[model samples]
Target: MNNHFKTAMDQVKAEEALILRTSSYLKNVENKNVRRNHFLQKGNQIMKKYAVAAALAVALIGGGSGVYGYYKIPVNYLSVDVNPSIELGVSMSGDVVEVEGINEDGNTVLEGVDVIGTTVEEAVQTIVESATENNFIEEDGSSVVSITTETDSDSVSEELTNAAEEGVTQALENENVEAEVIKSKIALDRRDQARELGISPGKLNLIQKLQKLDSTVTVDQYKDAKVKEIMKAIKDKKKEVKADLKEEVKEEIDQTIEEGKTEIDQTIEEGKAEIKQNVEQKKSEIKQQVEQKKSEIKQKIEQKKAEVKEKVQQIKAKNKNNGTQTTVESTTESNSQ
Candidate 1:
């Protein structure tokens, strides 16, 4: 009888350990670090195996930084891709990143130049300032450099264009590069033409601009139009579209805002489905720490004395649609007088 009592004690110890482990596991389900679908699947299994009162309660709480991407409504870039190919991509914060080559001559001009951390204005100054200091060009105090800004921006209110032009012109004059500053803005029609043709807006813009001048020009008719004609057509189309950019910007923003709400809802549902499936697979695998708990769970299933606490966390995720935006660009001739 003493041996029988010892065996009973050992069984009770195992059962107690199981209860402790399962209880801890349930508590962990409430942990934010744990994925929510884990609770959902495990919650479903517990519900099916045990009474509703003792079973798990499931609240599928989900959310994320939805629609993760980037778009540029008014992407502005300044470049002088002459022999040296100098292009400066300016960010919303005015930070400059070199998007083009620093050829031998370009490097000579930008030597010791801290272009990385500098603002657009400061960066342009650095280039032109270095150019003048190195005597790359004769500074005769005459506006010899023409600063024209091209973009697909639809807002006259966009200070980036004129701001870039004025800023660059000033930088040139500060060091006496003696360059003529002529600011030209280009806005293309049917900005969606690029999407339809699977080409860059800038490329489609040039094609469409050519078509504007010669109604015969079309995407399929590219071979008929010489490269020279296409280039000239875009220049002519510039004046016409420049005045309409600001109006178009206002309209584009309104259009996107209205569509984003519906699109975001669909994306959330898709995200939830993916999360649930992944969680189910992960929960099916038993961990070493909870190794002995599974059998104990079945044993305790008949007993209603054990207590299980239900913790529910609700997640409300607001998704911001990271949609695509159009960008337009144009380059000048190699030697601009």
Candidate 2:
């Protein structure tokens, strides 16, 4: 019984130790699971906050209502062309988003200028002022400043064109720069074409139209040419064409008058010839008729003369016969006597 009790106590102690170990292991596992759950909950909260932030960011960017959308979106492209051609990319709010020089002189004109974030008018004025300082624009009223607006929407283009014109005019007046301000609008495709040719759309368009009038007018020749120069060339070409046309018309009129005079002289000569021929023919006809009548009158007179002579001869013959017979009788009577 002592051995069996010892064995039973040993078995009970071993089982208790095993049960304690199992209980400790189970507590450790539960603690680990609780910590994992807590960490997962914190991570989920963090993920939710990040998701909300990301959604808000997407909404802001996608809706284009935020500051990033306001200043970055280009709504218009205004090109200021003189000797120095500068183009301003404007935002929807009229703020300038970019300033690009279309040519070498334009780049030189824009050398230290930072016009981004300014209004369209302010940018235009600044560029004009810079150009004036650089001598690209003359003080005399000989320079022509062409402002062309490029946009997809006509309304936006017109508005920006007017705004740019006003700005340039103001800048010129402020700088005491007397210049002719020309305002125009162009499509975006034309702007792209202009950029490809390294010229402003206004200049390119002018060159194109001038090309139509004069085929010798080339973009390469006039791409860097001043607006006033191009205008002068166009004006001179038109005058030349007008003068040529006038001369052509005058020549045509002179030729027509000469031709008409020649035709009239020929017609008069023909009429004179026809009149002479008709008068000769009528005279010949009258002469022939008079000769025929005179011939008939002479024949009748001959016939009358022949008849009278015959009558006279007959009377004489009769008288002679009678006288002969009377003489014979008388002679016979005389011989008898």
- Over 1-337, each residue of candidate 2 has an lDDT whose tens digit, in order, gives 3698788777765577899999997777776466434433433233334445655676676874444643465556888889788889876556688888888989998999989988777889889988999998886779999888886666667667766877888888888879988777787789889888878887887788789889976699998799889888888999999999999999999999999999999999999999999999999999999999999999999999999999999999999999989999999999999
Please write out the lDDT profile of model 1 over residues 135-203, one tens digit for every residue: 654555432332223334434214445555566677776764565443333443343444356433333
Q: State which candidate has the highest TM-score.
A: 2
- For each of the candidates, the C-alpha root-mean-square deviation to the true structure, in angstroms, is 52.7, 22.9
Per-candidate total of colliding backbone pairs: 11, 0
Question: Among all windows of ten consecutive residues in candidate 1, which has the lowest summed lDDT?
Answer: 65-74
User: Each candidate's TM vs. the true structure?
Assistant: 0.31, 0.67
Global Cα lDDT for candidate 1: 0.48
Clashing pairs in 2: none
